[model samples]
Target chain A: MKNATITALNHAMATRQPVAFAKNLSDGTEFLLPDPHAPEALNEAGRLALAADKSTTHVLGSESWFIEARNPAPRLVLVGAVHIAQALAPLASMSGFEVILIDPRQGFGNQERFPGANLVNDWPDEALNQLKPDMRTAVVTLTHDPKLDDPALDRALHSNAFYIGALGSRKTHAARLERLSALGHQAESLQRIRGPVGLDIGSVTTPEIALSIIAEIVAVRRGGSLGLRVK
Target chain B: MIDVEDVLSIAASWHGAGEQVAIATVTETWGSSPRPAGSRMAVTTSGKMAGSVSGGCIEGAVAETAQQVMASGVPKLLSFGVTNERAWEVGLACGGKVQVFVEPLI
Candidate 1:
């Protein structure tokens, strides 16, 4: 690898931006794609690689270039350090998400409660403001408290977070929606919230509920449809 | 979920130390391939290897090809799967085919 290529790759990796490394096998020429100054063909190749989230080889005439894409790790942000969160955090982490648990209450956000998990003991709104959820992020509010969950939902809805889910019963969600509507959120924007959060798995336990939530998040992330489950 | 940066850094350091290095990347796969596309493995001229291309099912063959790439300075696009008679010998009996591109780091 040349110094320029290595430097560009290092910068992209550090900044968590998606980039593609392209190499011409025939000529031993290598360069980083998406370079504004590069040829249009190469930039298109980079876009294809990033969109597919896979490495590909493109043959242009007699020239063959291999493009390898490097994408930042996905993130899952939970707005509550409750029991279901304790189960969901590790599950999401194992599923390749950088899990973050936020709660203002020290008793619930302690290390003992969430072993090997990243805990943010600040207020939910403040924590979310600092985090600034992006397209690769999934936000779930499990606190069920208006003070905690509502603020987090507001922040998540305003950001580019791919998935936003809130935990509550249908009646609770209706009341919550009324409150958010009063706060100036449009019905279309509020519809993004997957209230009653999770698939209809008939979950009665904390772990089961957590599983359904994680499953729903994965389904949404991978562009899978939420089909009705057979009994 | 192996970090691609780690593999690239290791390959760069090996090349900086004057050790010939080759990188084998999973370019494509069919059926139930364990590793996805873009998975990589770095191998040195001294037979030391890092990362994985096929989850231990075909590392030996890849490492051998990497050594050949290092010696010849030529890239090789190798394919392995259950259709080959040697697939059973190499433990790729899971009915998947993987295409690996082995190139020397120059």
Candidate 2:
């Protein structure tokens, strides 16, 4: 709780970086790992704490140290504020994501459609450029329009966004891939986009589809597998 | 995220005001613990507290233990569970065990 530690923690939260606080139980000595992304600066215990992404106690040479990880809030960027997005945004917010909805259409991106969510009234490409998706961010194109979804997908695929999903039928996804390939995107890069977004849940309603999408996003974020569900 | 910010900020303010402060974190959990391992609670010498280690199941015990830790300047690892028979009295009726580490923030 020192002033320097508080300042560094505030800075890390503001800048969306990961930090860890290590306290030696024996002497009450404290050290702050302000940058978990910089592996070269961390010791073995620090690296383990960062990889675990959890607060834990480790003992080394008769000294016990408690390492607490302070990670920035995860973020979700939804392109094309449609009905499914309206349903997904609140759910994502509840699941600890800073949700942002982007659309050029005023009617779709208005407060009425996305209440209690950050609405970006700009084109997908422009919005994404300013956002600059990182490793803690997930981008989903709920807008089936190729004009909107394609641009956003192009931006997300290139960035370090952890998850990229697009809503469409299998046939539509095939055509979408073809378009991106023609525009010089590699096959490996295009594979990062989870077309026909969301888990196969036999969804029909907007909320159901939103649930599936959120489930898939969580699975991808937590490094869980999308194995087949047995009857 | 808000919970973490609230706990840390309260701890910082208490320390700034020259009060002894201690933080108790849920280091491990077994079975159906309400809060996860990283859950934190901050306490001061004046008995003021922020955040929670469990869902009101063992906050009182942890807070009381935190005061002792702040006074003695020694960290304590306390555990509570249904198997110990005090779980019912402490309200951890969810059939789980939790280990909390209370340490002074100097």
Candidate 3:
């Protein structure tokens, strides 16, 4: 195996992109398939490894190859440190997401409320700008205040965030969508937002609601059929 | 939080420091293996080591093999399971089978 494959693996790890490393066990030939410098068959296998987030042995004609997947960890960006955020933050963390809570309110977004969390005291827009919601990120806006949620939602829609959610009632979500539309987000793009934000698990309390949202997030992440399971 | 193991970066830095290093990964498992596939252990020829392919079952053997791989620049694939005669040597008596792939960290 060449040092180039290792270099590519470390580079992908640093840049937080998905990559697959294919090794021809027979000859010890190496390829890192972020668009491999190899045959088309290996590319197809690389794609499968990436989609499965798994590493395994595959046969290509005569040679046996091991495909190793290095996928970036999922991230959850909560735009409010409300009661639900308090519950959702830890839940998402436990479920394997780097949770970052953003709230400009010092009192609410403090370490006292979110201990051992990556808290951002900047405005939602500024926070999202620095965060750069990628394909592995899930952004959830829990603050019902239009002033806070709208900007975060706007920034999220403009990016590649896999799951975008907003906490509100059906009526509030309708109004929120209209406001986003006025900001020039097309209807097709705006449709990406899962307003009323959660699986319809009939959650009544803060923790249950947080569970519902995290469940939906996980579903989308795992490509489960229950993804975007809104009422 | 996301579970990012520090072992790979440690190995890379060790290589950067001019140490000869090798990486051992649990590439396959059968039955109830202690670690799943993709678990890794980094080994340097000077007896420096980090991470584990199998929880605690075969670090010593894997590290020894890693050192050999570094010296020869040849990758090695090893398989281990509970065998009646060798069960006392490696304590995977009741556990599952595991295949480890070891190669130099070039």
Candidate 4:
């Protein structure tokens, strides 16, 4: 029987057909395919097909695309090279995200602070024209200046960016919202903004605020609940 | 070549090599988990795995399951509840239930 099974496995490997239930050891467990006497036995294309068949499309809580959804790493565009942004760009890069830092304030957006980041010192809209935020992208405004933040927010609201945030206190956020509303942005459009961004971890320092904001963006991207951090 | 695509390519390469690999993903979270949903960790047949499922809370159990999946060829869904003692033992201190999907890569 073992010999027959082995022979069948060999035939299957050669034919690129899936080997039948040689075994179903356990649920959620990994199993090795038996080696077949074929050149392609070790590099079975059929196995990949089978694995893909078994792979499930799990939607994550993050608003951004799932890890399995795309062929490329998505971009996280930070409009403002603030102290917090200096901390954030590196963090995002290490976490497998492409980080782009934009600021019209040339001195602030220089390489000294945003090393290894795609630095754009143009105004937000003009810079964003090149960056091209997509649905798979995440956008954050750390500039805090209304002139810089507003145009970027306006364009982002119209774009496909999954996570959009603006930095400021609650009062500042309220005022920003009022301005956006006056400009004809609907309630839902304004809702997309994660203003006064980041999780409420009582972050007061640049690094701390950076952590809080990054955590919140991650949470939104993952579809995870804001939970105690928000409250 | 050492870009984000490279990381995913490495993952796909392992999957194609007939290695039993389990992708542990963070599907949802409540409080503070180090890694969130959509974060992937691939486990090799010999009991090594990549990616974080939930900080460090569920790594041990997930790793054990990953080895089994590599050996067994079955996919399983696991959930860790934050309130459970095992949660603390597993590292779900944030009181969130993280759903992990463990499947053999190939």
lDDT of 3: 0.85
Which pairs of residues collide in model 2? none
Interface RMSD of 1: 3.6
Q: Give me the displacement of residue A92 in model 3, in angstroms.
A: 6.5
Task: Give the C-alpha miss distance for residue A164 in model 1, angstroms.
Answer: 0.9
Question: Where is the poorest 10-residue window by lDDT in model 3 chain A?
Answer: A1-10
Give the number of the best model, judged by lDDT.
3
TM-score of chain A of each: 0.82, 0.83, 0.79, 0.68
Q: Quote the positional error of residue A32 for candidate 3 in Å.
A: 1.0
What DockQ do the predictions score, one after another?
0.31, 0.36, 0.24, 0.14
- Ten residues in sequence with the least summed lDDT for candidate 2 chain A: A34-43
lDDT of 2 by residue, B51-92 (tens): 999889699999999989888878888888777466567665
Q: Give a tens-digit lDDT track for model 1, residues A1-231.
A: 453465677678768788888877566677777788767898898889888877867886688777888777788999989989988987787786888899999988999988877889998889999999998899999988999999999999899999999999999999999999998999999988988899988999999999999999888887777722232
**Which digits, one per residue and each the tens of the lDDT, describe model 2 over residues A1-231?**
355776777888888777777766566667777444533334566667777777777777777776777788889999988888878988887787889899999988898766667889999999999999999899999888999999999999889999999999989999999999988999988888887888998999989999998999888887777722222
The true-versus-predicted C-alpha distance at residue A119 of model 3, in Å, is 6.1
The best candidate by DockQ is 2
Model 3: residues with Cα > 4 Å off, grouped in runs: A1-4, A81-96, A106-135, A139-231, B1-4, B82-95
Sort candidate 4 into its docking category: incorrect
